[model samples]
Target: MFAVWGLIVLAGIFVVIRFTGLIDHMLPAGDPPNFTFAPETPVPQARNFFIACPPGRSPRTDRAMPSPSFDATAATLADVMIETAPAHGMQLMSGVPGGKPGRLYFLARTPVFHFPDWVEVEFILPEQGGDITFCLFAQSVYGLDDIQQNEKRTRAWLADIVGRMGPSG
Candidate 1:
């Protein structure tokens, strides 16, 4: 009787996963994406940087790529800090854009409660010729409790970074 019930439940789950299109929608559509993490180099000055984005979103596209833009409303940096600051409110002391395509650097103060009392973010535009290597790091931070609590928050940061992509080249 138990085996029969288990089979029935399994069949139902399979039907929903297959017929409901959930499996197709949830599965990744392309090759695995690469994310890079590099310590800032001199000239650029040594600092921490990570790049994360989904597959098919690389800078190598021949398709007409739209210049990146910042979120006008809640997705703005200020909005993001407002949402993320209490748990890890870091002051954004300075921000500079790279001369190339869309590179950006941010200096932020670490919340009193968190480790590494300072965190810097440097995001380079794919158009400038770079691979996205920071996605793995973002995933790791989301996995670790000491860094970020939820992956969604990390994703928000990624979105904000992507949002900062420039309008030209």
Candidate 2:
């Protein structure tokens, strides 16, 4: 009887801990993010490598810093990313139908937990045939604490982009 009681208590504790986090990942983090422009949304930003993710959590944000830039047309860059993302093990979840020219907003699953993470990429076409600025935003579906997996995944994919696309900026 005591053993059974102990197991029930443990299970109850586990379920309770899972739901009590103040933030829920299913809700929008803020205004729909715009990747091509500087933050017009209220998504958290990192200051001097410190992010105020929450009032108490330490890692702050899962977003990458100094949004990467590329020297390619928005259409071309978006094509490159969509094609290459699967090779990097990011299974596509969803995106704009016909894939939104020169921009992409989609969700992918992490391998281990199949955790969902959102990534937005957009390119700003500079005048005079200048380099296009690649702005990217990624966040985990489980909110602020993704065990740093979100950041790691973003960096790895960005490096892959640089290697394959050879972004000039």
Candidate 3:
């Protein structure tokens, strides 16, 4: 039937797009700093994103540790993120404010469909000199529902980071 043939052609086109990396061009890599990580409403209502805020701020507590300075903590975070991302099918796209000690953005692709997702992480250092904290926001670029994929990926990354960072405060 014509409908079946059309479907086959469309599927082939999608496969080509995925293989050729054209999907990256089609999906927008949103502004990292613009992502909201507020405690009251960390994630959007669409169930396509997950946000982990600092302790005492959100329902999910982020990993934190005592550090002598922000630079040291940022370096540690960057190393851990770089090591862990590839394991989860992610690659660092860019960083806000030039580089770390600020926000980092990553592009992740789903295993099956190769759907694109953007993850933004911001390192925070309290003025009072307490523990260093970071907030992470991950969202799908082309879906209204990700079936909790963002949450699972966020949790897995956090666990890996925590393991690499050793005991947290």
Question: Stretches of candidate 1 above 4 Å error?
Answer: 1-88, 93-114, 117-119, 126-147, 150-152, 158-169
lDDT for each residue of candidate 1 in 24-88, tens digit (9 for 90 to 100): 44542221112223322111111232233334333232211222334233234334443453443
Candidate 1: give the clashing pairs: 35-132, 35-133, 35-134, 36-132, 36-133, 36-134, 40-47, 51-134, 52-135, 85-89
Top-down lDDT ranking: 3, 2, 1
Give candidate 3 regions above 4 Å deviation: 1-11, 28-30, 40-43, 59-72, 96-101, 126-129
lDDT of 2 by residue, 22-115 (tens): 2234333333233333333345542211111212222224344554566777777777777888865664434544445556665665663355
Q: Can you give the TM-score per candidate against the true fold?
A: 0.26, 0.59, 0.72
User: Across residues 7-111, which tens digit of lDDT does each residue of candidate 3 receive?
Assistant: 999999999987888876776555443575555654455668777765554433332212222333667777788889999888987744444547778888898
| Better TM-score candidate (2, 3) | 3
Q: Of the pair 1 and 3, which is ahead by lDDT?
A: 3
Regarding TM-score, does 1 or 3 come out ahead? 3
Candidate lDDT values, in order: 0.34, 0.56, 0.70
- Each model's RMSD to truth, in Å? 15.8, 8.6, 4.9
